[model samples]
Target: MNRILMLLFMCMPVMLWAQRLPVHEKQKELQERMVEVSLSEIQERLSLTEMQISQLRPVYKQYQKKVARLNMQNHKLFNRMNADTLSDEQAKTILREYLDRERKLYALNKQYMDNLLEILSPQQVIKLYQSDSDIKRKIRMEYLRRTGKPKR
Candidate 1:
């Protein structure tokens, strides 16, 4: 009984820490699920063969993950800037970093676009991009609705 109690005590902190994780982490998980749903919807719309589906999902999953990561970084940078007033020097530095991050994200997106071309036909690629844009727009709208945000 002592050993069991000791084990429980040792695990308690980890459990509490997990529960205390920032809302951002939970929001990230929710966003990831939305991405999955968006991707699956795209997949359903595509006329992919079995082999193509197998090849496409993983590459696209990476694309989705990288986009999400870059967006999170972009948001973090803006949030950090907003969290405090900054000197001209500090603001200029953060602006440069933001620009650099945007360039990196553009490059990442271009790389994935090229990668997708290697796996899919031009027509299919066009369809995929269109579907992704549509799904993301719908997801944004749904999120706004759920949060009771007024749409512009």
Candidate 2:
């Protein structure tokens, strides 16, 4: 009983990490696909000019990359906290960093959206916003179907 208990304790973190791997991969793929779809949909619906698309595309891509990086780091920190290896001070520092990145990304996205809106009509912006969620849901469902997992 003592040997079994010791083995279980030793393996617990590995088991937990294994479970998280699939979920993390799924989420990352979903997020990247959604961003791709969003940009295309916005371009199509707004009939964005070539110059506008060129300018806006890089802006979106840059911010998306930044958001993904920060989010991944945050997840790593959170997983450490979950494993009881992260100190309170470290967790607090990571949380603050995450929040700051989130706020900055939000502002950047908003600025890009505003620029696009200047190029697109109000109705087009509304349509783009509405379509975003629907597209993401569809992509997620399709992903789950392919992977044989229930949609989360």
Candidate 3:
């Protein structure tokens, strides 16, 4: 009885952790797939050489990870703002954090562009940016269409 209860307590955390492992792995796999798709689009739009693609892959992956982290932070801040009992100071703090994340995102974009310039022509870099925006817009439109939501 007592020993069985103790064993169950000991195994509970391990069981919970094992359950979480697949979810974490799935998230990682999705992120990798998104990065691959983005890279392929950029490569095709820029008409990148093999050498250029090799150079861009690492820089782009790091950029994507940092951007994802900052965006997650911003999403958390937005969720915090939705709390019904939020106070003025709390609201101000969340606003500041949100703006800080935005600035960091901008800095990340600038650094990514600087790195791209080293491997690509200015025109190619410009087209890459435009193509990225178009891709995002298309994704958003598709989401809206599937959800039957009107454009804001």
The 0-to-1 C-alpha lDDT of every candidate, in the order given, reads 0.85, 0.76, 0.88
Residue 91 local lDDT, model 3:
79
Q: How accurate is candidate 2 locally (lDDT)?
A: 0.76
Best by lDDT: 3
> Model 2 misses residue 23 by how many Å?
16
- RMSD (Cα, Å) for all candidates, in order, is 6.1, 6.5, 3.9
Best by TM-score: 1
Which scores greater on TM-score, model 2 or model 3?
A: 3
Each model's TM-score, in the order given?
Answer: 0.77, 0.60, 0.76
Q: Which stretches of candidate 1 lie above 4 Å from their native place? A: 1-18, 22-29, 82-84
Candidate 2 residues 46-144, lDDT tens each? 687787677767666776777678677777766655636678897788778878877877887788688757756778667766776677677778879
lDDT of 3 by residue, 23-88 (tens): 999989977987888889889988898999999999989988999899888887786556567898
lDDT (Cα, tens digit) per residue for candidate 1, span 34-91? 8678767877898777787778878988888888788888898888556367888888
Count of backbone collisions within predicted model 3: 0
Model 3 vs. true fold: TM: 0.76
